[model samples]
Target chain A: MNTNLYDYAYELEKAMRSSDEFKHLQEMYKSVTNDSEASQMFDEFRNVQMQLQQKQMQGYDITEDEVMRAQEIANRAQENEKVTMLMEAEQRMSMTITELNKIIMKPLDDLYGSMA
Target chain B: MNTNLYDYAYELEKAMRSSDEFKHLQEMYKSVTNDSEASQMFDEFRNVQMQLQQKQMQGYDITEDEVMRAQEIANRAQENEKVTMLMEAEQRMSMTITELNKIIMKPLDDLYGSMA
Candidate 1:
C-alpha cells in the first residue's frame, strides 16, 4: 500500500499536538494533577459522568435523581480552580479533535455519507 | 510543552493507517471511485445523508417521508457493487477511527470522563 496517507496522518497528529488547545489541555492537566484533593474530586466526577454515558448508550434512561447527583458532583469539582481550568482546556481539546475527525473522515463521508 | 505526547499521537496515526481496516477501506474507496456510475450514486447518497445529519444536529424532526426518501436513495446506491463495497469499507474505516479516538482521548477521558 502507498504510504502517503499514513504519512499525512502522522503530520496531522503533529499539527494537532502543536495546537493551542492541546497545549492548554496538557498544562491544565498538570495543574490539576498537582493538587491531590482536586485530582480525587475530578476522578469522582469523571466516574459519575462515565456511568451516565454508558447508561445512555445502552438505551437506559437516567433518572432525575441521578442527573441531580451528577450535577452536584460536577458543581463541586468546578469550584476548584485547576479543575475548572482543566474543564475549559478539555473542551478546547475536544473541539480540536472533532474538527480533525471531520476532516479525516471526509473521503469516507463522501463515499458513504455520514452513516458511520 | 513536552513533545512526547505529540510524538505518541503521530505514532497512533501511523498505526491507524497501517491497520487492516484502513487498508481495506482505502482499497474499496479506490474501486468505487474508479466506477463513474457508482461514484455518482455514492455522491448523491452522501449529499442526502449530510443534509439529514445537519437537520438532526439542528434538532429538527425529520418527517417520515424524508426518511423514506433517504432510505430509497440508500437502497439504490447499495445495488451497485462498488457502492456496496464502499459502504462496507467506510464502516470499517469509521470503526478504526472510533477506536483510535478512544485511545487518543484516554488521558482527557480519564480526567473528564466521556463527557466530550
Candidate 2:
C-alpha cells in the first residue's frame, strides 16, 4: 500500500489533542504554572521523578531513603489545589499514552510472543 | 464530544500495521532473527546502545573511548545483510514515532512555548 504509517500516526495524535481530555489537561497545566509556589513544587517533584525513573531504567534498586524522599515531595506537590487538578488531568493523559504504547508495541509482541 | 480518542488511536494502529512499511519491517526482522549469527550480533549491538543511552540520559558525557567502542560494535552489526535490512526498517519506524511524539506533545508545547 502507498499509505505512510507516520501520516496515520499524526492523524491519530490530532484526534487525541482535539478531545476534551487534552483541553482540560492544558487548562490545568496553565493554572499550575501560573502560580509560582505551585510551579516550584512541580519542578522539585519532577526532579525526583526523573531521578527515580532513571535509576529504575538502569536496573538499579531504589533505596528506601530515596523512595521516602520522593513520597514526601510528591505529597507536598499534591497538597496544592492547582497541582492536584493538574495531576488529575495528567493521569488521564498517562492512561491514553499507555494505550497508545500498547498499540505501537504490537509488532514487537507479535514477534516475541509471550516473551514480549 | 462523545468520541473517545482511544478508539481513533486503535483505528490508526490498525492502519499502521497494514501498511507496507510495517510489513517490510516485520519481514526484515524475521530474516534477521532467523539467522543465529546475525541474532547474536544484533544482541551485542543493542546492549551497547542501551548502555550508551542510559549514560547519556543520566547526564554523563560520552568519552572518546566509549564512542569509539560503540562505533566498532555498530560497524560489525551493520555488516550483516539481514541486520542491515532490519536497521532500515527500524529507521523508518523511528521517524514515524518522532512525528507521533511531536503531535502528542502539542499541549506541553503550547504551555511551555520556547522552553518546550
Give the best candidate by TM-score: 2
- The residue-by-residue lDDT of candidate 2 on B1-116, one tens digit each, is 42567676677777767777777888888787778899888888888999999897766778999999999999999999888888898888767666667766665576557323
**Candidate 1 local lDDT, A9-74, one digit each (tens):** 545555665666766887887787778998898889999999998877555678999999999999
Runs off by more than 4 Å, candidate 1: A112-116, B1-84, B91-116
Return the lDDT, model 2, position B33: 78
- Chain A agreement with the truth for model 1, given as TM-score: 0.88
Q: Please tell me what DockQ candidate 1 reaches.
A: 0.10
Worst 10 residues of 2 chain B by lDDT: B107-116
Per-residue lDDT tens digits for candidate 1, residues B26-105, read 78877877788988899899999999888775556789999999999999999999999978977766665665565455
Going through the candidates in order, their DockQ values are 0.10, 0.30
**Count: clashes, candidate 2:** 0
Give DockQ: model 2: 0.30
